[model samples]
Target: MSVLAAVVRELGSEPVVEEFADPAPEDAADVVAAALNPVDVAVLNGQIPFRRLAPPFVAGLEGVARLRDGRHRYFFAPEPPFGSFAESVPLAGAEMTAAVPAGLDPVVAAALGVSGLAAHLSLTATGGLVAGEDVLILGADGQVGRVAVQLARAFGAGRVIGVVRDGDSRRVPLALGADAAVSSTDVDGLAERLRAEAPDGVDLILDLVWGPVVGPSLAVARQNARVVQVGNSGGPDATLNAPSFRNRGVRFLPHSNFLFSPEDRAAGFEELAARAARGEVEVEVERVPLAGAPEAHRRLVAGAAKRKLVLTTTSGTD
Candidate 1:
């Protein structure tokens, strides 16, 4: 048997493919899934926050692979070569991790950890989210955004407003449970519709596309509305009116933690598993042989892949 992977072919280029030996069934993981998360880059860039696992390491936070035995299968992360966008990271020791088993495809399963877990924390655990509260999911097509839309539905949100880029069909986010989907694609019309939907202002703003994109959206929130900062794709900095927030009692709550308590991680796994089992969430995926692991990084960086890129490893196979 052989393992497939995606690899970084060159700097600022797309990831390519290569195959390697497969893991014996005895060594293959039974639990199959790699949960993606938003981890900050520490040493280099992408996988910096995960430097604790290994400095100069492959940056992906999650993925899912077929497993055998009781072993778990996930994207193999190795210590990347410092100061160079080189090949695959080292895979010496058994560092494979397992994620919750749900009805989710391997892509969705790989996503269960970071993005899905983030959704669980932002909407349920911290916010005490309940039914009838409206949610505004900005950048709903992205990984975290998609999960957030689904989470809003599970928590019984009264309405979900999906703000998406131009040329994107609203049906995808709508299928994820958004009541109304708007386009940020038309910047001119975005503000009016955003304000119109929130007669009292949106109860919660999941700003994955923060920065200037946040301006018009913030202006429309009602008193005591909460804004959760998840991503800064728009830019790193933005101005906010302190007096306005104080006067309206608007709250800014950024999700600040990645290391879920073991209990919390366990709970999230259970929750996502249930969702996958029910076929509530769908994860689109693109898979490659183990040798292409580097190409996976390249493509991921190039913004060329819409689905989660999966790298198959030979760690556990016949």
Candidate 2:
């Protein structure tokens, strides 16, 4: 059998299809890719200069594609966790598996894995989240941020405060399990107002924004609170006061290593996907056929029109 892998052979590039000797099913059965990850985006963004690491390598970073022979189909990133892309890649089946729940289409279920990984780790592992805790999810309209709203609630967060700029109530944290939701433009002194609602201060902060938006709000964290930094959506540069952290005994956890450990990735995806299969985890997709991959890539580079862009071979427009 021939394996279909996307290879990125150069710097400032995109993945091109390459064939590999599909190993005997008895050897190892792991195949599926979800989408380009933040590191892939970083490489694409030239943050660390992916080309400097290795030349003529596989460029597709993360995905939840499929694995045959009784394996779980998922959206997973390849491991090492970090790659220069590669000449030969062993797509980890664990990171790729996502449970296909009833009432949820495969594409949407496929879409949930990567987003769910980020949401799960932040709320459980790093945030040390517990039942009845209140959370402040900055830039909550983002892919992972939006899902963080739901997972936090499902994990038993008492209230979720989401910050977003999208029109319509799509960013509503309440619907996603937040007791209340707020728009970023909802009047002045937003953090103070939020503080008023939770007098003791918020327990966990899932921040997609890292700059001016969240710097000041660092004060809103309770003593021994956890602030999980998942995205640089607000720009990478920020002014952080040593006193604020020292005073609060706050903890900061980096969010980009979701694919770092396959064991952890497997456990995380399995749990999240089970929820997806049950209709608790949801994904909204703007699907494009395989032939449209090039155009879709262009749209992504130009700036995505919607949060999730899923390429699909099947049509289940339910």
Candidate 3:
């Protein structure tokens, strides 16, 4: 049997839709919706040192799939060569999958898998967010940042402030439940802008971009506040003044979704899914057909995809 999938013929190359041998029934699950994530791009370009895959393989890291029992679930990290972008993916049993909420849309479920889990876990587990506490989300225009804004509000944040690189992108987070949005276009004035919105300082900081902005974002951290470092989209290195953070006793925590146990990840995703179903949490997403993965990949690499992109199969739409 053969199945259609987005295959990367070589590292650093665009994915091409083509037929590939189907996985055996014992190892395969019917794919519904697959999320295109930055990690997927990293893995594709061989940028992830820990996970290096040879080319001519299916392209996607996580997605929503149908189990044999007719229940839909979100699965991640399919064994190499078999990815969620395909109609049938070789998922390794129930260990790598989580049950999706009954009423959640498949595309939403897919979007909520990787990015949702990151935002949900980083805020609650790593950042130790408390109800009525002020929260700051860096890189608020990105997928995770956008979701984090909504999750923070839904989770009972007192004030949610989002920081974007461009002034025009500030509205992206504002519409997603952030109380205020600040542009980091001028790094020198970022701290002032953040303070104007969060005069008392933020209780929890979700730092998605670690660069010059990190220093300013940290300046407004309340004493004992936790800064959860999720990504470094802005740059790989950040300069910080030791005394600034030391005097406030602010805690910096590094976060990786892979570090969470499967159970913890599932619980976080389930909670987000529940909230999304009830309209309490929402992520801006663009739905693309499975065959359009190549174009999606191009947009993702070129940084043109402003919203979360989910590859939907025919069955996924229904």
Top-scoring candidate (TM-score): 3
Predicted candidate 1 versus true structure: per-residue lDDT over 29-65, tens digit per residue: 3223332232422222433544443321233444544
Off by over 4 Å in 2: 1-9, 14-33, 36-38, 44-59, 75-105, 166-175, 185-188, 258-260, 314-318
Q: What is the C-alpha lDDT of each candidate?
A: 0.58, 0.61, 0.88
TM-scores of all models?
0.75, 0.76, 0.96
Per-residue lDDT of candidate 3, residues 208-306 (tens digit): 999889999987899988889999989999999988998999989999988989888888888888899999888767999999999998898888987
Q: How accurate is candidate 1 locally (lDDT)?
A: 0.58
- Using lDDT, give the best candidate's number: 3
Off by over 4 Å in 3: 93-95
Candidate 1's C-alpha runs over 4 A off are: 1-59, 65-99, 102-107, 167-169, 186-189, 257-259, 313-318
- Evaluate residue 11 in candidate 3 and report its C-alpha lDDT on the 0 to 100 scale: 94
Worst ten in a row by lDDT for model 3: 90-99
